[model samples]
Target chain A: MSDSSSILGSTAAPDREAHLTPAANKLYGLMAEFESPAQIVAAAEKVRDAGYRWWDCHTPFPVHGLDQAMGIRATILPVLVFFGGLTGTIAALVLQIFTNAMSFDLWAIVWVRGYDYFISGKPMNSLPAFIPVTFELTVLLASLTVFFGLLLLNGLPRLYHPVFKSQRFARASDDRFFLVIEAKDPQFSRTKTEAMLQALKPLSIEALDS
Target chain B: MSTLVIDNTWDDPAKRAPLVLNHDRFDTVTAEICRVNEEAKPPMAWYVTFGISLALLGLLGVMVMYLLATGVGVWGNQHPVMWGFPIVNFVFWVGIGHAGTLISAILFLFRQKWRTAINRFAEAMTIFAVMCAGIFPAIHVGRIWVIWWVFPIPNQMDMWPQFRSPLIWDVFAVSTYFTVSTLFWYVGLIPDLATLRDRATSKVKAIAYGLFALGWRGSNRHWHRYERAYLLLAALATPLVLSVHSVVSFDFAVSQLPGWHTTIFPPYFVAGAIFSGFAMVVTLAVPARSLWGLKNFITLRHLENMNKIILLTGTIVGYAYAMEFFIAWYSGAIYEQFAFVNRAFGQYAWAYWIMISCNVITPQLFWFKKARTSIWIMFIASLLVNVGMWFERFVIVITTLSQDFLPSSWGYFTPTWVDWLTFLGTFGLFGTFFMLFIRYLPVIAIAEVKGVMPQADPHYGEEGHEHESEHAFGFQPRRPEDKEEDQS
Candidate 1:
């Protein structure tokens, strides 16, 4: 069950032949395993060459430099976070402006039956009073931006995925390493795909039959 | 021709008890260590925490009911001291929150592997602390029901919250902080939840855990995305943590009040937040390690590292205190000069001394390695730090306001019984959440700690040898058994 030997010892490099068994895809795909970080990276590169735009690399821990090596771009979550924070700021400003400057203007001007009360003779729309709200909005928006943005960016709440169907995939969370190329990738073909993956020196190659 | 002694850290294989490979071995080890006996189902520590937390929670509940039934006027918030226990509690909880972020984000950036054991708990504390913090400000508002007025909306009442108000800014700062902290906690929990889901016995636990796990099959694809997101969150959170506290400090600094107005408030507050936060972590963690029998997991090395930070930040905060006094003297502004003078030798001189002893003197003991590593000593020091920090807030709030610009307006502030009860309640609330976290969630982050093992950490390839030494010291790894068949 350890299967460490098969994963660690792949000698038939770039074996170009394909044995066709349509039913073998699910089990076969999982049989092909990765033992080291280097092998996973190599498989990822080949996955990219095979034109699979959407795929991932899984490991027990964060694999250093995997994102760049896998050619994943910077996330849009930051920009989303920025916008959320911007909204918080604007909301804070408008609320204060309406309440203190516009809404309360008449009372301020009237000044309790013309008995003059002055806070350093400052105007009704005092910008100084707005500091707290401005500070709060900036924080509010930015925090929300990060929170909701992460969820949307990750497409979370997904209760199922094709990878979950493979029992071997579970170890990817604990000890194993994996490189999964989605079937939706443009250049995905049975024979050429397996050949390309074999060249990348995985333990073995298996099609995701399902 | 090279004759050099290359002493490996892990010298021998099979030195310690084998790693607990099967679920049964792991569970038995935990049950024994955690003191789960059928006759005596709950441990003494459990009773203490539960009883204390429940009593505190009851006090909080009753106090909150009174506040709701009457008004915020129940507590002593009179002239000159407009912000009282509510603001103090708010600041204290926020400060408590700072340690978690310091542990999770800053240490994460530095790749300090030692943090793995406590980061999960630390982050949980952050979320809970923030939760407690959020409650204070909500009730601080006189019309608690209309708290939504702080939000920006074109309501039927034709009103908007003041944009430039420091209070409004706090609302945003705290809410944002809460959101980000929650997400950070949840994101970190996903993999652990998946682990639990796979290991679940009952159908309900499996389904519940599975749902939360988000169908995470640990595909390379999912991990690739998850890691990217985690790194991004840590990056975002680091600055956010600093800014959030800076904004909190701005609540006081932007004011022209004698003690409150200062340019250095932002950095000063942030440093103090971290200082107070690390102190709280030690206060909580020392007891937790002993009670949970996790001495090996939360090692002396970890305690030493935290103590070093405590000392460094305590010094920085002390420096801030000195600089503030010096600047006040140099400015020659009568108001500022009087403020500093009154704080040192005025009506609240006792509070000032407490702050000095707790914040300044206590952390100095950490200068010695022996003191830092000694749990009892560190615990006492941590308690002093908290006491000092609370007094620091009290000094800042009370001393400056007690004597304002006008001689006629000078009046001393006093905390009534209500203030004491409410303050005590918050402690109850904090303890309640922490106890709950310990009971349910994996307190030690099994996966993360396992990752730090000799087999896991490639840099420390000889960890296997240290097992025997670890056992002699009264700790042993779980016995190994194959559960691979069940897993596959």
Candidate 2:
């Protein structure tokens, strides 16, 4: 998992082709096109069982059970969002306390602050008045975390990908489903992988170049 | 063969009308929606409307500049009724903003499949309405230049916005609502943008759409995370929808004013917000669906469903009004009794009557199926509801302030030309943004709409001999008999 995460982060940058000569650039992967989401799910299960770590399924919309088929673990986004909400809550409390309730004073020998200021005859550190801002800030941070966390987890903002260079790959976002097994996978062998995918009765198979 | 007796149960699938009509393939769904952006040139009517919206946008800019330069006194705000048109428009637009989030986040959470047809534009409307709503309070601060003081940024002045005040809570609530809503809208747009990117005929168009798509290749892993993020956002936004209007209500309910200070304001304001928001959706959608040639996608069923919501929320709001009066009477508070009585017979009596007739009376027509189905009736009712909601805020703000505890301070509030233009300019600004959005983006969510269609399901029509007839891409060929049934 750590190895895959490292690869996803840096080494597998899509633009690495710019550094290599035309002759040195190798085939990125073999992409098999499937007719339906069911077929792709079946293929994904097969690929997962075959112990191919660097393979992925692509579909027009999310297939209900594809995550299980691909052996993809549940995301850690909720935990991150939880911490974010906690941070927001603490920050709101500290900010409101320091700004509204506590005031600073200078003595003859030393300075002192944190004197409580009362407004509207209400007690200092009014918990009820703090609830709305605390709640709002918590939602704000948690939602922002969800958005950015998804992007980071997906390793997105990848404007170009080698798989996109395949002519048949355009249909992946329209009406077709695809399964791509990259050459970098430990289990990948051109002849064996091609024969294995061929057994799945895919619509077509194409080699994607880097 | 043993005869199978199909039970006619209340939960029977045969009783329901299909959500998607004229069942088509996945490819057709993409082609139909993308064709609007690809093949259909902007019509003369589109150009003319865009032109008018742009002129209005220019007018909005001029009005805002004048308001900032000449000061807030250009409007009708004065002693006793210092909170005038600016606050009225703010609450109105903010209330109008609620329907979009309700339809998008709340409906999405409830597993309402019908939301797919209109959720995209409804979410866009949420973002645009918030933008319009945010403009009012920023300018209403009087000292617009020092608006940053609202934030708790550390400064040499050592002064922070009073945290105990509901007004300060409103700043956090509204800004957070805007940010979360925008994120939800944009995240949903990425897949559809990819669809547009793939279909673009020109290189320039392709790159532009591609950039926004952020290299989305629709990988199942990515979709997994995307779906999770979307669900979390919807969960967060649900409470936010409740909190935003509740805090806005706190702005008034926390005050000592007779009409404004009521425990009922929270639920009352929230209900009114949803009511007005749904009305605005109907008002905009009725013409938009027809004008854009989107009758098939934004079907009459969607309109009927929305009208039913309008009916529901309208009743809730009317009930709240009655309860407010009943509570006032029940409490034996003389001031509260005077506030309610004065509202119906005061100088703003005309506005109060308009509010009741438009909000309570007009939506009751939706009780008849014919009225709900009829486009013209729904359109007129929706417009009336919009006017009623505006007057609702007007009556609440003006009437309460006009007849306060001291008879010496009593005065009628009249909006000046600047006040009227600023309100009109927000409409212009909202319309201008909406027009541009409709032109450039796929207004209906292409991917989400496709997700709801029959073909997208893995188990669609897998029973009996029909299993063999499952065509490629999960699209079963429509037989002549099936076509006839669909037509009937």
Which structure among the candidates has the greatest lDDT? 2
CAPRI-style class, candidate 1:
incorrect
Question: Which candidate tops DockQ?
Answer: 2
| Tens-digit lDDT track of model 1 for B279-391 | 88888889887776666566666777789999999999899999999999999889999999899999999999999989988899999877987878999999989989988
lDDT string, candidate 2, B296-337, tens digits = 677778888899999999999999889988988998989899
Task: Give RMSD to native, each candidate.
Answer: 10.4, 8.1
Q: What's the lDDT for all of these models?
A: 0.68, 0.83
TM-score (0 to 1) of chain B for each candidate:
0.86, 0.92
Q: How close is candidate 2 to the true structure, as a TM-score?
A: 0.91
Output the TM-score of candidate 1: 0.77
Model no. 2, DockQ: 0.33
**TM-score of every model versus the real structure:** 0.77, 0.91
Worst 10 residues of 2 chain B by lDDT: B479-488
Candidate 2's error at B263, in angstroms? 0.9
